[model samples]
Target: MLGAMSIDLVDLVYRFRKEEKEQHQRIEGVYWVTDLTRCPLKRTYEFKYPELTAKDVFSPVFIMGDLAHRGVESLIKEFFLDAASVEVEGSREVSLPNGRKVIVRGRADAIIDLGDNSKVGVEVKTARADLGIPQQHHIDQVRIYNWLFSLSYSILFYVTPDRVTQFEVRDSVDEEEIIERITSTTYPRYPWECSYCPFSVLCPHKKAHDDRHR
Candidate 1:
């Protein structure tokens, strides 16, 4: 049944052309593996506040310390125009292949702009003593952070209980011997080997070697 209707075929064509003219396509940026890996770490750190769960005995002391720390941070922030803000880029929990879950969160205390065209990541370690880490272990920690966060360099801020010396997190460097040790699938050197390691007494391999030597 063909009825004599004014079929506006040209109007339909004009509408189609208008619809196809200059449309903006939303493009999603591709994220790398390192970007995805940071999510777990971010979640872990943000959720678990160990201090909050702990008893209130240490609360006042912590608050006081934090106050003092923030003051120093304010001064440091003024120095870097590029990295003027201390932002929590990511804080999450990450899982290892061995099924152990670790909170891998890092807050950039203050990023220092090198003035030319560079930046440095600062991590304030406010403590009574220096964070004594096995050389190889320290290198691994720094190296991994450097790679993941795309940091050119980092600073380790160490503060004493007395506040005698305000420890600034500087590029104090890790040695090549530590690098060599990291590459090798072996134990640490003499002095480091003799250090009070938690794994020592329980190490069956170490016990066996000692027995054989005896």
Candidate 2:
């Protein structure tokens, strides 16, 4: 036995870290659908050089968002209990025309089935301020969910301290566009993403406009 030293050493921080690592290992090779849509360049970079893409800075808002996800999940579970609804994450395999297959996955806040094998995908989010309806990036994300789950409709909810704004979107897919974007030699979308990325300094596709490096 290694003795009481090991047993007494465990603390909340250490235990949470240990468990988080174990949970991450479950999806080591797969790309997260959410992350992919946010920044394909970073996604591709991380996929190519996983070791160099370690998270360096932790944002408090990001942490708060993680906690918010749990609260939203619990609330969804309670609301959908008596109704004929499904509130859960879903995953599907999508094959590119260029002969590549990827795992596209996401979770809906709540999916209320309206009969005839139709589902409504729901996405929940917390923001510092409500900026009207869904952003284009968000619209792109839920449409991907529609592609994955064959959802008939989707809704994006942006909640703030004082108000909640929602946007409803229809099902659409553009795999050709996504495939071309991800496989491109340059970063074509969201140059500002690099400014906030931890890998900005090291990324080859990083732009001069990325002020984080300046």
Candidate 3:
């Protein structure tokens, strides 16, 4: 007789997340496209205090979002004839307000070749709610992707519990705007961001929202 085998699901998730992070370790002083979408100070903290800013990669919400992105990428590969690329890496050099130059890099979700030499980028996101289907941060992310990849346009795809939808992002930001976002510490780019930030406890700029004011 054999005893029942038990699987440590938590351990498995942790390993998966660790492997992903290891493969995509951030470079020192290089800003990522995703950074432009979040509180600039958050990035500073992540690099400044690596130990304190370390996150539990095994988080279920984060895992679910990664899984959703993978599923969508698979669907694009299967259905889209012109889906020529996935995880397209791009980088651009921009000078900061202080005249110092830095590299901003990003990996687009996917790229679709129109067969006429034109291509479009894609950015996939998953959320728990459908409200504000096209989030400003997400839009900014895709727009920056377009600029990085030199694509005239890109699609912002969202997967939510209630609905699956996407929006077109044709406008792109200039180098000056990217530099501003990278250097600004205005903090909590979105009102609801602090509530979910892992470093909120250590962040001086964390928004203190009063329920009574709402």
Error of 3 at 116 (Å): 3.1
| lDDT for each candidate structure | 0.42, 0.64, 0.81
Which stretches in model 2 have alpha-carbon errors above 4 Å? Answer: 1-22, 25-29, 48-58, 82-87, 185-188, 208-214
Model 2 pairs in collision: none
- How high a TM-score does candidate 3 get? 0.87
lDDT computed for candidate 1: 0.42
Error of 3 at 66 (Å): 0.7
Cα lDDT of model 3 by residue, 1-214, tens digit: 5469887877887888888788877687689998889987778777777665447575678889888878888888888855558878888888776778899999988999876666898888888788867888888988888778888699988888899888999999888788888887677887778877778878777887642321
Candidate 2's displacement at residue 208, Å, is 4.9
RMSD values for the candidates in order, in angstroms, are 20.8, 5.5, 3.1
Model 1, span 106-212: residue lDDT tens: 34566666657556665554544443422333334444445435566766555656543332222332333223322333342323432333344433323222312
What is the lDDT ranking, best to worst?
Answer: 3, 2, 1
